[model samples]
Target: MSSINGKTIWVTGASSGIGKSLALKLSSYQCNLILSSRNKEELLKVKELCGGSNTISILPLDLTNHHQMEEIAEKAISKFGSVDMLVNNAGISQRSLIIETKVEVYEQLMQINYLGTVALSKAILPHFIANKSGHYVTVTSLMGKFGSPYRSGYCGAKHALHGFFDVMRMEHEKDGVKVTLVCPGFVQTNVAKNALTADGSPQKDDDVATQNGITPELAAKKMISAIEKGKFEVYIGGKEVKGIYLKRFFPKLLHKVVLKSHVR
Candidate 1:
């Protein structure tokens, strides 16, 4: 394994799910960690679970507040003088149908999933350029690569991330700034349960495919492996990972298969 001892890492959405798992696993590596989310209480809990070591600090953040990203990034850099890597894992899920979903739902999805991520990344870009090296590991879904029945808005936002990050990689390669897009197919998390519904309220329900998917720990492991290897992109999960290849080579077939499966 690549050594990260003494390096500083920053992770968003670290209060729960894959982010939380990554924090727990990274704690063993003896690296400085900065955890961010909208929930300070849960972040503190996660820090304690990671042995409450002095290497970890919690910084609460709400992605929807795009204007504050620059300031937050400044504070994050102050944590350990410099951050070697950043894991962009904070995002929301959607479960509403295209026709039934409200316009506000789409707007909210873009604000958080696409624009918010972009803002924070840009806030940290200058630092990476000045340092001559940094890594951005963003967790977008397989839905970012293809469309699904109930995730119209979600797919749109995720797709936007790919477009922006691809260009970032191209423009910043000379600066030693690396980008890794993590496309997770599914994982047993609260994503499905907390997905926004047609009226913009939480689904408060579970999805079969998501419930039976890999554990968050396993997903976190795969994500970190991709980051360590500096992979441009990595897909994780069960059979759903094939959707990426299918969409690339057989668009029509992927469409048929998706409709037939009724995934939600």
Candidate 2:
């Protein structure tokens, strides 16, 4: 994990947002990249932006389709020889209250955000174990640690990733495999517009907070650097994520301040 140059990295959700930015950044390092997402046309655009046409390949994939996950792993191996890293970046966000959210909506969020990630990781584990070296980098969210209004399901799925991947890291540490869980508070991405509502409909509108967040390109640069260093868990954001720590250590005062803040 010390270097990415020439390493075969399979990046899921590479069509846009943080994934696209990461692919573009990693391409500059001359890493052999295998990009996957559901949108073939968008993936092509991302490949173009990454530069070095020969260094990147697009494999359109839907992470929610568990049956096709094994096929993706096989094709990735075939295209790149063997994957040195798997960036589990494909996920959907939910923006709904627990009571108002439909059961199926929560289920779908879990399938895409947590189960799909685990499925792909399980599919790639054998190869890494056999090779005795690999890295798994996941882009989780600030909601993973802090519960917020209208995001219960999203929080649940993101929290699940940390639980699952933390154990995966411990179990495979001796095998030379590394897992890094990245938590970004909010970034300038289309995630808010596409986020699921109570009935599984898209949010369709951007929030003021999300629109004013950090750029994806900047977030991507920091994430890639963290992956290269093999860090276990890192938080990225302006100051909202840091407030979670304060809320933990100073409950009464933080609770009073939070009650007056504009979280909704």
Candidate 3:
């Protein structure tokens, strides 16, 4: 049996995309799940789809509301007595050039993607410490490792997650608290469609790269394996993942390639 089979897991952004896929996949493992998102209705839909022997609870959450994270964490723990893992997957994307993007857009991205994640993690830290066992699985992006055109704020927020979690991993190692950072290149989600443009409006369209990306099911499978193995980090996607390697060994070369690709 998988180590995750009987664990209690909390997954944010469970309404759709990778989060939804993970919820469904974990259900088959007999895991007790706490699914959270801004949309309670959609969370219920996902719960219904995860029909299995596992127990499923819905907790509607707005990550942007950092003030309420502690209370939400208490409620989450109360549902299952203890949470074995917390999957921080709720986030937004950006699709605007830095010059044209408004300052507020940057603040919004930081608030929801970075600060919100931190708040929730802090809220759950006490529980994890007391039990001396817990895992934090975060879904960042390829942009977290490298910068891309028109994704300044998004990249910044993802990078911040990497830094925060890296430190968390070190500090909590003796306490048996683990951290896994999942950096996905693209996984056939509506992230681009919901991405904020320079004017703070949704892009309302899918990018070519995203359209041709792997399915969420495939990404979730890879992520599950990484989690089960206690891996500190894993990357999922196509050629875009290569950029990370290039950035390390051939920075100038990757810069030229990125400029020529004309990514949007």
Which candidate's lDDT is highest?
3
lDDT of 2 by residue, 1-264 (tens): 348887999999999899999998888786799999999999999888887488789898887888777888888888878999999998888777888889999899999999999999998899899999999999898777766778888889999999999999999999999999999988999998999999999989888888888999989988987987889888888877776687578767665665666664
Q: In model 1, which runs have C-alpha deviations exceeding 4 angstroms?
A: none
lDDT of each: 0.93, 0.87, 0.95
Q: State TM-scores per candidate.
A: 0.98, 0.95, 0.98
Query: How many residue pairs clash per model?
Result: 0, 0, 0
| 2 against 3, candidate with superior TM-score | 3
Candidate 3: the clashing residue pairs are: none
Q: lDDT by residue for model 3 over 157-180, one digit each (tens)?
A: 999999999999999999999999
Per-residue C-alpha lDDT of model 1 across residues 193-257, encoded as one tens digit per residue: 98999999999999999999999999999987888788999999999989999999999999999
* lDDT of candidate model 3 versus the reference: 0.95
lDDT minimum window of 10 residues, candidate 1: 1-10
Candidate order by lDDT, decreasing, is 3, 1, 2
Winner of 1 and 2 under TM-score? 1
CA lDDT, candidate 1, residue 157 = 96
